[model samples]
Target: MATTTGTAAPELTGLPLLGSLLDLKNDSLGTFLRARRDHGDVVRISAGPPGLRATVYGVFSAEGAQQVLAGESANFRKDNAFYQEVRESFGNGLLTSQDEDYRRQRRLVQPLFTRRRVDGYAAAIATEVTTLAEEWRQADAGTVDVLQDMARLALRAVARILFGTDVDAAVEIVEKNFPDVGAYVLRRGYSPVNVPRDWPTPGNRRAAAVHRALYEVCDRIIAERRSSGAAPGDGQDLLSLLVEAESAEDGSFDATELREQVLVFLLAGHETTATSLGFALHLLALHPEERKRAHEEVDRVLAGRTPGAGDLDALPYVTRVLKEAMRLFPAAPVIGRRAVAATVVGGVAIPAGADVIVAPWVTHRHPDYWEDAERFDPDRFTPEAEAARPRYAWFPFGGGPRACIGQHFSMLESVIALAMLLQRYDLEAVDTVVPVASAITLQAAGPARCRLTPRNP
Candidate 1:
């Protein structure tokens, strides 16, 4: 155990009473970056007023991130206000579950996400990307919103993979309600004070309605699956595998647990990948040299054929492009955890019960670990380069026991989608400077419009 040097971490100065609340709300990413820039890697940020004030111990260095997320992860738990808000809105799925529940969920879901299993879904990903490529090729308007389009594609692909024959129903419900649900989670997650959810407040009411609808849809899907009599571990889709999963000691997820897991998969499965894909395309469009290199790589490896899991390794440059994009715009920019005990990270003492945040948004750009960090450079991810950096420096999918189970799945989907898209189109950025905000995920605050010209046209 590392001993604290009795030194207190520097605090970010903020306005009277509200502290950094307005700044955080208006520009969280900027505020975090500024915190790291003005102060050192470990800085204290306070928000809200006196009694209701929420103070976060912001860990901005790769070393600190490693300690909080992997080294001393037990000391840093997911019981923070942000996670509570997520659990209330999204249910205690693996993403929000803790301790024994998380352990059990991980054991059950881990087998379903093995490399071989995730690779099998590449066909589904290719199918969806190909479909979108065709739609883009045939569209009357040459320009499209990359973020919105990729979101649709990711949702459709994941839904199909998860639900198999029943994808249409799941996709429709998620597409319709997720935006609002995400908004609600973000609003309440950051707010210093929130009214009782039962108070019939507009936000509360809207959240409840969306939650009910989402739950009902998931429950209906599970019921249909059960009615079909699909045996455990026998069905092709993920939902079937989950439905059938069981343990002699732990048993399997009940209907409610199934619904929660499904909702979590739907939310996490699409959004993060969409953010990566959209940004990769946008970045490639802005940098023609990078785009051309990507196109060449895609053209060579794919040879005008659809990409699959095998091509993932074959197209290293394309993968790097996605990696670089993730570094610049990681989907989960700030990951929050509550400290269970007093701890020292990066030589700064963090007291027990502190709201600790390990921000990839800042760590990925940490000057000590990255040179020209803000620039989009895929070569930074070359095997040699990556091995040289601290493991947590570029952690877009997070770290520790709670790292994303869908890491492989997300990579496969992004690589396949990018390779296929690059193989089919010549991209140009119509909205060159895309404004972004940190919500539940990194979001495009403005339109990320790109002009797609068909390659063979």
Candidate 2:
């Protein structure tokens, strides 16, 4: 971090403000690593909001990521300069809330995301994946958009598991509104002067309109479930639990609280998984051997028929492949923190109010911690190989107290989905995709075109 303490400085690219922002906007990871290599691990740049400066670190060491995540309160706050941009879209939900609000909501949702609880949903999750694969199989052979397919499938899975409903209408609502939330929050850091929430700008108004529509849909779902008395015959789903969740202080969650939780889980839980699964498939297709080996692992573990909860562990190869894919292309990609007080990380002074982003994409691929860095190697995730790697070398789902609560759920879904897909079909990328880095999750700059075909193994 460049400070006025007369400390020696390292070289940096771009000019002062524009360089960091340009590098970040263009290629997030590249800019950071390139900066780190030129300046140092702890480099300070004047980007982001006015009062908020950015301190970038290439924290590939697992211990570091763990510490940051575990020590979230001491070192960070989620509702920082950039996060405010997305608040209208996300509300005071778990993912975007700060301090005590985060803790309270996390408690309510914690029990539901337990490994055992998530395990119960494994079959259902895999069933959704299999169902989607079968749908793709039924489609005429040609360029299939894996990203779009996975997004819809993931949305439906969450809708069923969390909301206890088919995503039929939810899809239209999300398709129409999801972007509004992201665009409202993400594009150029938010400010009262420019991207004002109250402004009648077409974009802002559209985002606001979507916000109202989403809550309206959630209200209807809650009303329907309440009116029906949530009869026991239908399969168990997330909506049932949410509707039934017993609050710690209060007896139960109120309508307003439930609305935010549903939206949070619906978006946070599913969108990320979709991007990740799609990225996994994309990477697997590029490396045929990895794909074949992953397919073999699924075959050996599950053979024929559907994969169940217990089968997830038996499919470690599938897990490794998934982890390796996430390592290479983390869906969320970056985790940002705002320093609560003046502190030093790697001997750099982090001014209070500064925005510190620990970019997983840069750290995951850092040569300081990874060999080859760019190659697809599931072997790296083998227990022994992982033991040799730094703790933060991988943060696809992030780490620490504020880390993704739905990590277990997402992983199970991914492993089972990948196993089921590879066992029954083969896929390969079609045209080159221009990777786009936006949304709550990372997606192809353009839709990922792929040729999906039935596989025999």
* Candidate with best lDDT: 1
lDDT of 1 by residue, 318-426 (tens): 9999999999999999999999888788778999889999999999999998998889899998999999998888899999888999999999999999888888899
Top TM-score hit: 1
Evaluated at residue 399, the lDDT of candidate 1 is: 95
Every candidate's CA RMSD: 1.2, 3.3
Worst lDDT run of 10 residues, candidate 1, spans: 1-10
lDDT of 2 by residue, 1-457 (tens): 2232433234355555444566666776566667665666666554455455444434333444555566545666775656776565666787787776777777777878888888888767876887787677667664577778888888888877866555677767877788767666667453324545686888767767888999888888877776777554443677777667676574666787788888888888888888878878887777788888888777777777788777877888888888887887788777777766655555455556666667777778777778898888889898998888767778887777777889888988887787878887787877554466744567567777678767762
Which portions of model 2 miss their true places by more than 4 Å? 1-11, 16-19, 48-64, 188-195, 231-235, 247-251, 432-434
How many angstroms is residue 284 displaced in model 2 relative to the true structure, after the best TM-score fit? 1.5
Off by over 4 Å in 1: none
lDDT of each: 0.90, 0.72
Candidate 2 residue 271 Cα shift, in angstroms, is 1.6
Model 1 Cα shift for residue 202 (angstroms)? 2.6
Q: How close is candidate 1 to the true structure, as a TM-score?
A: 0.98
